[model samples]
Target: MIRDALLFQLGYNATLVTLGAMLLGMAAGVGGTFLFLRKRALVSDAISHATLPGVGLAFMVMVAFGGDGRNLIGLLGGAAVSAALGLLGVAWLASRTRLAEDAAIGAVLSVFFGFGVVLLTMIQTMSAGQQAGLEGFLLGSTAGMLRSDAMIIAGAAALTLGLVLALRRPLTLAAFDPGFAASTGLNVARTDLAMMGLVLAVTVVGLKIVGLILIVALLIIPPVTARFWTERTDHVVVLSGVFGGGAAYLGAAFSAALPDLPTGPIIVLVGFAIFAVSLLLAPQRGVLSAVLRHRMFQRRVHLRQGLLALAQGQPIYEPLTLRLLRREGLALPDGVATPAGRARAGKALLDETRWQLVRQDPSFEAAAAHYDGLTPIETVLTVDQLDEIDQRLPQPHEVSRP
Candidate 1:
């Protein structure tokens, strides 16, 4: 059962559909990274919604011409045209009007989608429309996907991926800093339009498998999830593609196994599950990891401060300070610095002094080195030197004062 559901059994139709969905996911993931980075994620939503009227209109036109209304190429071509128009409209609104990008996106999304609904209703009244299966474009119906339809999706995915790789550097620069990219003689606007074209292609290809309503989730969720695991743009893009492909594969397999299930929503749910897990558990940026890092930094700060107080012959047994000192092996039970503790305290104060001096004179490379964890801990300040340094150094509370 598992093997058959997973396409390992070589069921021709099942394998083709699964492959198509996976490729669509990968292309959306790669293209969506650019949109995500440019802070234009909602533009994808508008584009996807705007494609609906095109799909409905194409079907009606084909039927009126006495041709098969379900022609995949015709439907996809219409979707591409309308999606491009919608994207351009949003851009134009943002640039030419008082409306911000978000308001433009929202306005375009609702207007296009509402018009699509009107077109869909009109189509349903046509004599041949009942057999058109146009509603599948709204909610998705992967079970009806033909081998040729799958091929179209695969070709689009390959084209999108190729273009992204060929233009990676320019696109990266444009997304991060358009002014700098333009200053370097790159056509930032052209690069941005090319990216939107890729986004349109992905949205059109995805219409058959994931539907218009949910396709934006495929584009947005994977990239957002990938961000939790990396800081580098390149890594985030690669991981987003992997995550998107994984979700598509699993969703298709599960949907195949359960004949009543819909592929698009299932895929989105799986992607959301992955995002939730990453948001809470990823080591570098997850909520749990951030909390733990914050606690560790606080403890280190407290220990260093307590050690400095001990070196100054000041009391170290304040509840929080004393606990932190004991934890770091810097204070004996008698609330005094051990010999080793005294040595570490002297080093800490010296390190603090160098940090302060570096702050005052930013060109002090040697002082910067100590804070980088490159300086050996053998460096120490005598009690008198520490005392003199303390008199000039700003206290922790005073450092934050105006």
Candidate 2:
């Protein structure tokens, strides 16, 4: 069944739902990058939560007007309006008052969500709203999704993605350096509003697929996962989109294959799965790679210290140090140094003495600062510098005649 869904053989509705989810994920990832960069990730949470009131209000309005309150378009439009208002409220509280942005976000998120819950409760009491299935907006449900709804989702997602791509430059600049952008005649505040607007659009459109609560995961997780793989902003954005799209595609397919599964939660879980893998395995910043690098650094420190001890004729007491020496053929079982060990020891001692001399000399101050005990002296000093330092070494005394 999973294979059939992945192959798009689960019928037209399943295919459209999966494809729409793909576009939504991609738009969320691309749009969320700026939010993450700006350290405003919580704003997405606020915006998403704030959509609930809109959904409820839209439902109530439709019911009051004698129409079924379950129209996807009307519900999404209502969500957009509510999210935009919420975004504006956060901005106003942050900029116009003494409250921190996070505080504003928290207040808005709680208030709007609470109000939405009350609305939902009220909705349940009404005969028309009882079976409205408006509860699906909390997480998400694709069961019996209409073809027109799927088309709407897919087209709106594509439009969002296109706009995000078109404005990537200004958004990227504002995120990284609003001060500099302002100096260059860009309106930082306006750019920020534009960014929030895009986020609002994504939050509203995503209310059906990932829903209000889980959409935050769709917005934030992919960019975070992408951050583990690269340092460049452009690469991070592109990789984030790819990861988001893939996770959503697979997640939607999984939900379709197993009809019991909820679409929103399944999608969020899949995204988290991708994030976990990236956290553990990406070479540049992954946990496993970091551990390996630490071990390599520790090995270098141990070897350097052990070589210094050998050069100074110090007793090797540490078992690991002795084992390391033996493994490198530098010393014997009894801790006796070999001929090769002696040669290496002499070079190590000379290098240590040279470092001491350089440190003691005021002229070599800049060069001496690079010494980390593990860094080779040759790498720090030029040929002439080494020659000058070597010339200063103690000359062998002439044997006195008896």
- Maximum-TM-score candidate: 2
Q: How much is the lDDT of residue 139 in candidate 2?
A: 89
Q: TM-score of each candidate? A: 0.87, 0.89
After superposition on all C-alphas, the RMSD of every candidate to the true structure, in Å, is: 6.1, 3.3
Over 3-100, each residue of candidate 2 has an lDDT whose tens digit, in order, gives 99999999999999999999999999999988999899999999999999999999999989999898999999999899899999998999999999
Candidate 2, residue 242: the lDDT equals 93
lDDT of each: 0.83, 0.91
Q: Which stretches of candidate 2 lie over 4 Å from their true place?
A: 128-130, 347-372, 375-402
RMSD of candidate 2 to the true fold?
3.3
lDDT of 1: 0.83
| Native-to-model Cα distance after best TM-score fit, residue 262 in candidate 2, in Å | 0.6
